[model samples]
Target: MLWAGSKGGLEVRTSAGGATVLRGRFPYAVPTVLKDGRERLREVFEARAFAASVAAGGDIHLLVHHDFDRPLASRGAGSLEISDGDDALTFEATIAPEMRGVSYVADFLGTLSAGLVGGISPGFRVAEGGALVKRDSEGLLRVVRSAELIEISAVTKPAYPQAQIEARNWTPCTAAEDRTLVHALNRWRL
Candidate 1:
């Protein structure tokens, strides 16, 4: 199992209707160091490494500090959504005040908004024959071509120093409003 922290792509925000949304993009091809027993390896995830897992529609949970006992959202409960993109694995989770009879959602959101939480970390396992290894001046390097995405968590310390989390307020714009805004900008340019 590998827990890879993303590079500055996690966001926590509240919508106008009081729905809290957590969105993240875990970037691929970002090199990070991982410890394997007594050895240290430089690992990079290739593009679409978790394609099969996302395509399979497996349930992946949103947890805190990688703790299974502290799950915040899950795909099985329709609160989580995962997708694989060209350069990253994207996820969006809607968190309500109370879910599944759990009342800690607000507390968690408070901690997150207070800047106490670190960033997003993806827990995954590399598939068989999914990695290529090479040794160079940079020591051992592992290029991961395929993997199974298990869960994404908010942790206190992240392997990637650039990982970040932020809280904001969001409001959705209708399509007609979008077009009107674009048209106004275009007319201003003319």
Candidate 2:
């Protein structure tokens, strides 16, 4: 998963049950974390067909680092859909009580609303092994590859600087990704 999100042009609002909502644009270009521990961007653009596939399932999820186990909530309880608008992929997510334990998500939204988080990252899946292309830092791909569709999530720290910016004041990192922890205490009162 690529790290992204920071301060600027982000609108966050708290709804019933303390659910935080926000809409933002993320890159369509997919990146892979190879088993050998190398990362590279893929050239195959996931514009509409990918969005259509996820929309068809209508079960997009709100997660951190593309970690399914760390899902804060599901799109079904709210709305998580992607639209390809002018080569830009925009998504809107509504996190509900189902994400009660994930307080950092609230904080992320709060910081984002305050223009603290300024980037969006793609949370996707790809086949274990396939004829994939190798892309350079400039996103120049050579060969063939494919990535499966999944949910796009909001992250406090982005792996790629171009992908998203990390807020200097926001220090909640590991705690933000602990999906297994049962957060009974509500930190965000927004």
Candidate 3:
């Protein structure tokens, strides 16, 4: 599974669960160990307080979050969506600015799915209202959020399972993603 959050800087955690740890982050850092009894893994970064801000504004996208000490400017456009029953949502996207890249569409859809599925799958699933959806399309995909939707980004693809988890030039969400998610979390009902 994948976990993305930030305590101060930028943090993205993806794990399959085991003693060995695989982690990466923005600002370029090393992976550390994090254990809480049943789960023993490495936590390379913490959730940044401004995480929501960056995400909603599309600060973290299409790049590895680690090894870079400089700031990155937003390069493209995107969209966000949410399922009516809270089943799914497309929280963010970063399609090519020229809008000629159809390949990137697949990656965006996959990332959206990865975000929500990753968020809910691992004990992190918040209440029905705790989720937000975002998507970015440079082509015909026109990203949408739904329980039935199972794709994201035309150019985006999952990293090697056994490779060290790193954030690279993948799609980045807009800061609005956070605001949208916060609202969804607050408004969710049984």
Q: Which candidate is the best by TM-score?
A: 1
User: Can you give the TM-score per candidate against the true fold?
Assistant: 0.76, 0.52, 0.21
Ranking by lDDT: 1, 2, 3
Residue-level lDDT of model 1, residues 139-186, one tens digit each, is 677787886777898766566564221210012223454323132122
Per-prediction backbone clash count: 0, 13, 58
Instruction: lDDT for model 2, please.
Output: 0.46
Residue-level error in angstroms, candidate 1, position 158 = 0.6
Which residues of candidate 2, in runs, are more than 4 Å off?
A: 1-10, 14-19, 28-46, 67-70, 97-102, 110-116, 127-146, 159-190
Task: Kindly list the per-residue Cα lDDT of model 3 for residues 1-190, writing each as its tens digit.
Answer: 1232222221233234311111222221233322223433333322231233334443332322211121111223232221211211222222333332434333433454465212211101122232232222321111111111111111122221211222211122334543342322232211
- Model 1 / residue 147 / CA error / Å: 0.5
* TM-score, model 3 to reference: 0.21
- How accurate locally, in lDDT, is each candidate? 0.68, 0.46, 0.24
